[model samples]
Target: MPHAYQPPQRRSRLTRRGRLLLLFTALLGLGLGATVLLPLLSPGEAPEKPRQLLIPEGWRAAQVYAAIDKE
Candidate 1:
């Protein structure tokens, strides 16, 4: 009697439910990272410093030029 050949069983890398679960998990992680972690990791702007300038009373233009030249 002659025996019939049998084909090998096929295996799936990912099932439909597994694919959906993986996609959902990836989206959830991204959403949490953007909403919760991004702000915590970002740097805030530094506070501005006050500026001051001084001018002498009755100062002549020539005097200012001489003072700047000395510096």
Candidate 2:
């Protein structure tokens, strides 16, 4: 003997408005995630700006590097 087959039941799903709300939430999450992660992933070099520093005439390049590294 064989048993009769039955159709599968439909799943409860979000309505049209609920679908749109979910999409909006997903996009917001993606944008915020990118904003926080992008910086740490690629820290672009600091812009090179021309600035003058006044120092004793005798201060050599090595001394300047040492002084800056110490601070």
Candidate 3:
């Protein structure tokens, strides 16, 4: 059987602006994905819990050291 002659289809090409838009979209997606997944990839727990020390209103570091020195 003989095949009928057919015209070739025009290939679609991306313009420079379209290519830049695609690149921008891809980078934006990657950045958002990293932001979402970063917390899950971090360490499970902090090494130590934060502590708050209480000191009397008028006390100073020097006074604290002097008190410790007398011990």
CA lDDT, every model vs. true structure: 0.83, 0.88, 0.85
* Model 2 regions more than 4 Å off: 1-9, 46-71
Q: Candidate order by lDDT, highest to lowest? A: 2, 3, 1
TM-score for each prediction?
A: 0.39, 0.48, 0.51
Residue 61 lDDT in model 1?
88
lDDT of 3 by residue, 15-38 (tens): 999999999999999999999899
Model 3: runs farther than 4 Å from truth? 1-4, 46-71
Model 2 agreement with the true structure over 34-64: per-residue lDDT tens digits: 9999998996999888866566789999998
User: Which lDDT value does model 1 have at 7?
Assistant: 92
Q: Relative to the unseen true structure, what is the C-alpha lDDT of residue 36 in candidate 2, on a scale of 0 to 100?
A: 94
Task: Give candidate 2's TM-score.
Answer: 0.48
> How do the residues 1-71 of candidate 1 rate in per-residue lDDT, one tens digit apiece?
59888798798689899999999999999998899987788897776786543458889888877776765
Model 1, poorest ten-residue lDDT window? 46-55
- Model number with the top TM-score: 3
The clash count of every prediction, one per candidate, is: 0, 0, 0
Q: Give lDDT: candidate 3, residue 60.
A: 88
